[model samples]
Every structure is written in C-alpha cells, then in structure tokens.
Target: MSLLVCAYVFVPETNTTVAINEQPKAPFNNLFGFESWRQTVWDSPILRKHNCTLLNSLSSQDIYAGDAVLLQLQNELEVIKEHIDQITDELNLHKESFAFRIDNAFEAIRIAQKVTNGIVYIG
Candidate 1:
C-alpha cells in the first residue's frame, strides 16, 4: 500500500498518569505508540518468523495480490457451479417424469368415471 503521511494531524493522546506523554489533542492513545506499534504489527513473529514475510515489506505497490488468486478460484467455482446445475437439471427431469406418470393415472381415472356415468342414465 501507500504511506499515509498526514502532516498537522490532530491525533488525540491523553495519558491519565503523565501529561508529558500527551501528543496534541484529548483522549488516551497508549495503543498507537509509534515504534512499538510497528514492531507489534509489521515486525511480529507471526509474519517475520517466515522467510516469505520479507517480500511483503519490500513491495510498496501492487497491494491487490489476492486478485489473481481469487480470479483462478472463481474459475474453479464456476466449474463447480456448472456441475451443480447439471445435477439439478437431472433431478428436475426425474421429477417431471414422476409428474407425467401421475397425470397418466389421473387421465385413466377420468375416462373410467365418464364410462361409469354413461351407463348410469336415469332418463
């Protein structure tokens, strides 16, 4: 990423113990110590312990490294999505066949009903 250098920034710092530790504005900022913050975050053992961590510090730009990885992952996801669609299509086809069978049964019952009604004439 880019360096966020803001000159004349009003960063609040209120040390309850010592006024000497105060920066400029009100409220405490024991959490935002400069060198300690750098060491804790940029120089932590979680990152610094790995040999690959040094490469991250070297790069000033090209912050969106995950884009290429995500693009590849999206392609894979699309393939899986297509497979799921195919499976769903097959399932729906089976359901349609079952529905057609039911329709055939209902048609047979309707034809039998008409036949029975034809013979039961009271006129």
Candidate 2:
C-alpha cells in the first residue's frame, strides 16, 4: 500500500477546551497543498519555522478561519511553489513518481492560500 500524509489547518488553543471525542474542523489535507510521502519531513523543525513565519505574517493576532490571513498565506506559499517548480523541471527525465508528488504539493499550496487558520499537520 502507498503511504499518504495529510495536512490540516486549525485554530491554536491555549487550553484543552475541546473534548477528546470532538473532531476539529480543520481544513482538508489538500487545503494545505501537502503531498503524500512515506517519511516525516512535514513535522521537522525547519518546516515548522516556515509555518510559524507565515502565521506571524498574518494580520490577525489570533489564529482562526476568517481574519484575513489568507492573503499572507498565499504569499508565503508562492515561495514554496517556486521551489517545487524548479525541482519538477529538473526531474523532467523521470516524471513518473516524484513528479506526481510535486504536482500534489502544488495543488495543496494552492488550496492552502484560501485558508484562514493556523496550520496543523497530520501525517
């Protein structure tokens, strides 16, 4: 079976007000433009730093789904999209497996641009 990693965007809470049984309404995995992979690169500190930078750039002081953070996120995603494009172009000789992942990553970032919540990744 193939491994699938999903990404989610949600509100960051200071306390555990939510019940354990409740499921968060975070954005769909595809919303963040994340791609499926076998490893755990998404949880890395470097990536988290990038995510933090994006969030810090948002207008709203709190993380939520409608505070006008979308624009900022979109702008941040552009940088990642450019890098992915470059890698995809370089791998033109083998556009079968990794290429598809690159495509998925692009799609995820595109969707993430419209999101308003802070990013919460689940793999």
Candidate 3:
C-alpha cells in the first residue's frame, strides 16, 4: 500500500497584522486561505457532492501569523461547526464521514492556537 503523509511547515511572523491582513491590493485576486484535501475527497462523483462546500475558503493568509490570522482560523472553525449542523440535518444517514472531518479540522485549529500561542502560520 502507498503511504499518504501530510506535512505542515510553520513560519514566523515577520511583519505586523496590517501588512499581512490588508485586503489584497489591485494586483492580487483578493482571496484567502488554502483548499483542504477534504475538498478533493468530496469532489468524487460517487460521493454525491452536496451543497456543503462551506469550509472551502479561508479569509486570511495561510503563511502568515497574527491576531487576524488566528481570528480567521477561529471564524473558520465556527463556519465548519455551522456547516456540520446543516449537513447533519440534510444528510442524516451519512453524517459520520463529514462530521468526523469537521471535528478533526476543529481539533487541528484548537491545537494550532494553543501550540503557537495564537500565532499559527502555514508554509
């Protein structure tokens, strides 16, 4: 069997939150956050991808650490929680798979906040 390993690289904050959180300038696309593998997994045709694509976007930079970034992370957790609730209602029969992923993501966010002292950055 092939192994699928997940790796994350943490970087330090080099500038203040303003420098990092500014709503991307004209040259940029103004979008934030990284797409999780959850996206790809749910995209499978057999899975019957529903309208529960809420956790797909994050409103802050993934490679920077700051209060705004942490806030964004927290917000994402809340979003996931809400999505979980909605999805559970819609797909009562198959809530385990989705709920498990949401739970894992929430736990990951909590751990990152604790370990990094609210300064979690992805590289």
Candidate 4:
C-alpha cells in the first residue's frame, strides 16, 4: 500500500449569530501522492528537530492554522531535498522519485498558504 500526503484548505462558514451545521468547504488544488515516502517523512531529522506536529502525528487527521506551519514544513522539505542524495541505498530510497514527491508536496503546501482565515488539513 502507498501513502499519499494530501493538503487541503478548509474555510469555515462564518455565521456569527448562530452555529450552522454545515460541512466545511475546501479547494482541491493542493494535493499530491507521497507513495511510500510516508516513512521517510515521518523519520526526517529536520522535521523531527523542529517538532512538526502535522508531519509527526500518527493520526489520520491533522490541522494547522495559518501559514507559519506551512512555511516551516516547506523549509524542512528543502533541507531534506538538499541532502537526499547523501542517503544510503540500504534504506531503499529513490532519490529522484523522492525529490519529485517533495516538489509536489511543496507546491501543495505553498498553494494552501494563500488562504486567509482558513485551516490546512493534512492526511
């Protein structure tokens, strides 16, 4: 089985007077398949060092408010991309494929960062 890392921007309904029982709306522009790279991301030293909640959580549902988390994840991905070539073959990682996945995931996060008063959902 392959794991796909997808990010979506969810804008909550703004009903100040009374609570509305309606599903949140999100755009499908930000999405990418991570394939088998879930473990790689979960074990990333750069992400671990920064204590990325979204990336580190084992839960299927994770949410982050604002672009700060998005920017931090993007930076960590950049650091991993820089040193991806240094990873040993013993880990069975494809440098090119993994790099492509990182790029796609980066773009997804970048797109999600543009939404104001919206929460980012990762799963």
Candidate 5:
C-alpha cells in the first residue's frame, strides 16, 4: 500500500490539487526538499521516459485515443521532455553560479573584516 502510494506520486504534476493528507509537520518543508525531489527526477533517463509516457497517457482528455492522437501525444511529450531537461540544466547552472557568487562575497567580507578589525567590532 505504501509502495502503491509512492509510485502514484513519484511523478506527480500539479494538474489537480486533491488533498493528499494532513500531516502535522516534518523536518523537510522547503526548497531543499524540492531540490532533492527534482534531482531524483532529473537524474534518471528511464524515470524521465516513464514519466513522459505516463503523463501523456494518464490524462483523460482528448489527448488519449487512437493512432493519430497517440502520435500527437508522443510528439507533445517529446517537446515537454525537452523543456524539462532544459530547465533542469539551467537550474543546475544557476545553482552553481549562485554558490560561486556567495563564496566570493563571503571571502570579500572576511577580508574587509580583517582589515577593519582594529577599528571596528562586529559584536
């Protein structure tokens, strides 16, 4: 039952907002959790392909049907996969850039603090 629930939500897109449950609280409740989740998704080509096919087929809309519809769904799925991959790459690049900038900024602050230590007190 737990495995079934996990499998169902392992690639949940925000198409609908059915209340999952009401848990009191948890340690991971922020961007870090989302980042890890995203990494899990972006790390696996097989998983991505699985999600792509599942998402395209699972919807009950006009996209689900005969050969022509299936082809169009496949095409649209390919486009969505490309976009997801591109976004993941861009997010990784930005994360790296932000870390670099923050590191540099901290280094600058440290140097400045050293230079002003005789005349200034931080605390």
Candidate 6:
C-alpha cells in the first residue's frame, strides 16, 4: 500500500476552538507519497533537526502548531536545495523528484500561511 503525504490549508471559523474539524471544509493537495521513498523522508537530517520523525512528521496527530511546522519545513527546503547533491546521495533518492516534492510541499505551506488561523494538515 502506498502512503501519500498530503498537505491542506485549514482555517478555523471564528469562535471554534478545534484545530481540525471533523469534516474539513477546505481543499487539500497531495505533496508526495511515502512509499519506497519513505525512508528518505523519515531519515532526513534536516527533518530530524526540525524534530520530524517517522511517527510524527507530517502526520495529523502532530502536536506542533501548523504555522510553526510549516516554518520549519520552509527552512528545510532551503537547506535541501543548498545540499541537494549530498542529500540525494545520502538518501539514494532521485534528485529531480525529491526536489519537486519539496517544492510542492513548500508551496502548500506558503498558501496556508496566508489565511487567518490557517494551519497545515499533513497526513
């Protein structure tokens, strides 16, 4: 089975305390899939530095605020771009595909940051 990593922009209605509603009204986009490449993301040194782990990283159960996590992901994107060669070599990932995935993830986070009370949902 393939486990897809997806990101969404969620804006809670005013007066609502829930982070994620039972049925999310906002639309979401798929960023990447954690299939054969799961290990690459799970073991990323940059992600690790940001406290992302296999179990918690990008999962809906993540306790960190979405904006905070998205900020960390943005930082990771810069580092990944700077050390693309090394990261690809270390993770045995396709450079182009990995770059594309990271870029899409960043874009999703960027959009999420624009809305009031917006948060990212990754699963």
Residue pairs with backbone overlap in model 2: 32-108, 33-108, 33-109
Best model per lDDT: 6
By TM-score, the better pick of 4 and 5 is 4
What are the per-residue Cα lDDT tens digits for candidate 1 across 12-116? 354111112213222211121123224343334433333224222423321111224323323432333344444335433344433332233223222223321
Record all residue pairs in model 1 with backbone atoms less than 3 Å apart, i.e. clashing: 14-27
Candidate 3 stretches greater than 4 Å from native: 1-9, 13-54, 58-66, 83-85, 88-93, 117-123
- The TM-score measured for candidate 5 stands at 0.22
Error of 2 at 54 (Å): 14
lDDT of each: 0.27, 0.37, 0.38, 0.50, 0.30, 0.53
Model 4 agreement with the true structure over 1-123: per-residue lDDT tens digits: 444444444545642222122222343223333534445655455456555555655234443534676676676667666666654243456776666656666655655555454333444
89-114: candidate 3 lDDT, tens digit per residue? 55442566555544444444444454
CA RMSD of each candidate after superposition = 33.7, 9.3, 12.2, 6.9, 21.8, 5.9
lDDT of 6 by residue, 1-123 (tens): 344333344435553333322222234344554654444564556556544453235433432236666676566667667777876787777998777666655555665566665554444
Off by over 4 Å in 4: 13-37, 44-54, 58-65, 88-90, 118-120
Candidates in descending TM-score order: 6, 4, 3, 2, 5, 1
- How would the candidate models be sorted by lDDT, starting from the highest? 6, 4, 3, 2, 5, 1
Count of residue pairs whose backbone atoms collide, per candidate: 1, 3, 0, 0, 0, 0
Position 98, candidate 1: lDDT: 30
**Which has the higher TM-score value, candidate number 2 or candidate number 5?**
2
Considering summed lDDT, which 10 consecutive residues are worst modelled in model 3? 1-10
Tell me the TM-score of model 6: 0.61
